[model samples]
Target: MTRTTAADVRRDITARYRARTAKSRARHAEALRYLPGGETRGATRISPYPTYMTAGEGAWLRDVDGNRYLDLLNNYTSLVHGHAPPGIVEQAADQLLRGTALGTVAPPQVSLARQIVERVPGIDMLRFTNSGTEATMMMMRAARAYSGRDIIVKIDGGYHGSHDFVEISVGAEAEAGLEPKARLESRGVPSSVLQSALVAPFNDLERMAALLEAHHERVAGIIVEPMPNTGGMIPPAPGYLAGLRELTDRYGVLLLFDEIVTLRLAPGGFQQIAGVLPDLTALGKIIGGGFPVGAFGGRREIMAQFDPAQHDQALFHSGTFNGNSITMVAGEEALRRLDAAAIARINGLGERLAAGINALFAALGIRAQCLGYGSLQQIQWTDAPVVNLGDARRAAQDTGDLHALLQAELLNRGVYSSNRGMFSVTTPLQESELDLALAALKGALQTLLPYMREVAPRLLR
Candidate 1:
């Protein structure tokens, strides 16, 4: 085997993707009239144009052009059971017949809430919202209100939601020279909002501690994703989460675990595995059963702020579809089906996929690596360990062209990964699917090797 340089990988991948895009571009041109950018989500858009999928079943998506591909992306990891799982579909269909949304409390909501409270060790109570973005927004608001403080801390490169407060420092470029302290990422976010956030590097406990000490009084809470999914998946170093817990306690800052993406790690989530309980937790994706849902819950006292009965203390939380019957029924069914054994089985499959891909990279002599925690995995083009958002930015800057190449190649080979290499294994995916993926990866690498040898020779060396 010969090692492939990054430059060669980029050239080959671009060429392959360019050829594939010719087909996708035509569909996108047709779609632009109906949907902006030919897609609903910006994250789904890629160079050339997004491939339009007509339908999905199990772990496969059929594109509008009639191309079938293994759906490793899994609707951004929302379909834990894969597309249109019988259990979820049947339950949702039954609930839809009953009604979609009712203004009053629903039995399904209570049932799902009970299930969450039981599985998640730290959540003593819970409240529902329409999306993970809403859940995180409420969590931050509650933390600020509870502590009577202005500033909140978040891990650099961590993504909580699209809300203004937590969006700071997300996907920042390394060239921007972001400081150890937080830096805002968008305009019109309000200087006050930017000032209110403190950013620290993931896995850098010392820097986190320093920030905590410096802003002890003003810091109201610290929100972190147990394993950050954006900027590639970066798992916390051992004791890193525990250390954050201890520091938050010392500084009297609320600890919020944004498990929106990491919840699939286990039935109880990363908080259980790390043994570091937060004051609040945010959840979405799998819990919703393919429907849009989000939840924030923790200590009973802290959650009491949202009680509508309390006139003066109410948190003003209200949503037309919050705790709606349809979401609740579907969520409950999904939760019922997702027991410890099921989680273990899916995570095991994820481990297998990760290991297989890593082994393939080694065999192909590629300067690439797979990184993730539990079921969520990302393939980084560089060999460097991604510890924080800055590290991810640097990696992206170093290999953006290569990363883009690999993404196109993988898609052409019938494996649908996210633009950033994020892939999740659904319960439906088996060893056969993983094997196919590995083979596809090998073929992709082979196709790029010659280009690498001529271009970025250092990667091979």
Candidate 2:
């Protein structure tokens, strides 16, 4: 018998996916006439054409092909309550009729802001934006203005947003080692932007301190995801966050926590759970109640920079849809419903999902491990301790296309999630849905075993 290779598995998966998603393929072709790569967001793109989703209800998504799948990705973890929650829908509809966007701040906007400040620790005040990208950008700018520094320290492989300063070292090279010199991950980013960003290793306190110490004079802020979401959902190692807080304080540099995805992890986010607060916190995703929104806020002194009273020196900030009524009311409703109990329940489910997948991997004698903090998960094909982005980068390099193949297999089995092996549990997710996802995962693993044994036998050992 011929040894089955990963390429063979990929080819088979692609062929099957193409056959099943003919309509989506056609739609993608039609989309190519106007949109770049037939999609607006790069995350949704996948091999053999991305499935065009038609509708989503609760934790399920219906594709254009009329196939329904349990939505494990949950729109990149923006929908904590899943899709079309009754209260949010009603609130959004009401706000739409009243006005989606008003020139002045609306009642709903104030209400939502208050809710955020009350729940999320360290946010004395905040300003809304259209997306997380804008939130992070504004936070960094605020830090620069507050500290009068130009350089910003960021974790390697940490994704803040699409902004020029943050668009560096995101897909950092594993072989480059710790605190690799900032390299732009995308084209069109000027060299000045790259130079202004100092890349540091995640969870490694000593390395982080060294980077800050070396460049503390020029450093305005150290921006990080409290629990890294895009860089494989890696949690902070014990005192990692506390250490960051200490270093920032000692250096007089602001600390900005990007809680866009991890906000769903706790009632007050991972910062509350960890008990380490930053000077500024960037929030998005679930806060919008399944709509577009982002915010950054912190100490009153820092946030006051945006206060119009200080006209001459105030950081100039304005957006046409900054505090849009629809998202505001919907977000307030979403936050209102996401109580402590709901957070605990969803986080518990995420833990169970990670544990179940790890058990399956162990049973199959694989070197794979499911890593993440509460309510988020990522399947890393390495047993190594994944404390930082470099470790994650190594795992990604080692796994080759295993994750992609697994993702394709999962989709084929009627489950949808990130092809990069990330998944998040929604508030409305049932235990039965998790069970089904686990079953699909197990089947996916079994199907990939031959390829694993041939291409990278260490994974099966």
Candidate 3:
């Protein structure tokens, strides 16, 4: 008898997907007329044409093809309470009528700023921006002004946001060590970004210290995601964050925590959980209550550089929609509801899902592991510890086929997630949704057995 192959299984899955998502195919074809790659952003693009979503409610999303998914990705971990949350939507609507952008700071904005300063350990004062990208950009500028330095250190493959400076060393070649080679990853970014950047690997204290020891004189700040959300959701190694604090203090360099995605992990972000505070914090995602928003705050002295009272030395910082009423009220509602209890519940669910995923992998006798912290999880096809971005890339290189199969199969069963093996649990998610996801995984694995046995036996025990 003839044996099946992974390619054959993939072809079958693609055909089925194309058949079911006919309307989406037509929609994408129409989209090709105006949008590049039939989508506005790179993250939302999916293989065999992206599924055009029409509506979302709570934890469920409806595609243009009229298919409903459990929404595991949750708009890339932005929606903690899921879509169209009643209270948040109501407040946003009310603010819309009053004024979206009134050109002055509203009481709602002041309330949010005070609320965050009270809750977060590091933030003493803050300013709002339109997106996380803008937040990181301003935070870096503040650090530079505070330290009177030029260079900034970042992690290899750690995604801060899409800007010229951060575009450096992202997706660089994985090499022998954690030090970044400083390869420019994006096209439009100037080569000068490499000069202003120093790169190090996550979870490695000694290497990090070495990088700081050499460049501490010229370094402004070390910007990091407390629990790097896009870098495979890897958690900090024990004492790693505290060690960063110590080193920054030793060198007199500021530390900036990019808590855009990791903020959902705890009440006051991973910093509070780890008991290590940075000089500045970049905030976004869940804080916006599903609106477009970002904020950067730090010690009052550092933040005062933007104050008009600074006279000639003041940095000119202003945005048309900086403290817009709609985003302010919506974000306040989101934060007000996201108490310690809600954080604990969602984090508990994340743990449960991680354990269950690992168990499933073990039962199938596959060399895979689920890695993450709190409410985030990543399916790495390697049993090797994914302590850094290099390891994540290795898994992607070796098991690209496996990753595609898993996502395609899951989507076939009314589940939705990132094409890159990421999963997150939201506050609106139910245990039943998790059960459905697990079942889909089981079926997908079972279906792939024949193909795995034939083509990718290395994945098998």
Query: lDDT by residue for model 1 over 1-461, one digit each (tens)?
Result: 76665565565566666575566778888889999778877778766567677799998888766778898889898889888888789999998998898779988989999999999987999999999999999999999989999888888778888888976888654643456556677787777787788888778889889888888899989898988898768888999999999999898899999998888888889999899899999999889998999999998888988877753767888898998888888888887888888888888888788888788778878776788876788887667667776777776663435555666788789888888877798888888888898888788767766665565444553
lDDT of model number 2 = 0.88
TM-score of model number 2: 0.97
Model 2 lDDT tens row, 77-119 = 9999998998899989988888788889789889999999999
Instruction: Quote each prediction's TM-score.
Output: 0.93, 0.97, 0.97
> Which lDDT tens digits does candidate 3 get at residues 6-120?
7788888888888889999999999999998899788887888888889999999998889999888898999999989989999999989888888877899999998899889
RMSD of each: 2.8, 1.4, 1.4
Task: Please tell me which model should have the higher lDDT, number 2 or number 3.
Answer: 2
Pairs with backbone N, CA or C atoms under 3 Å apart (clashes), candidate 3: none
lDDT of 1: 0.82
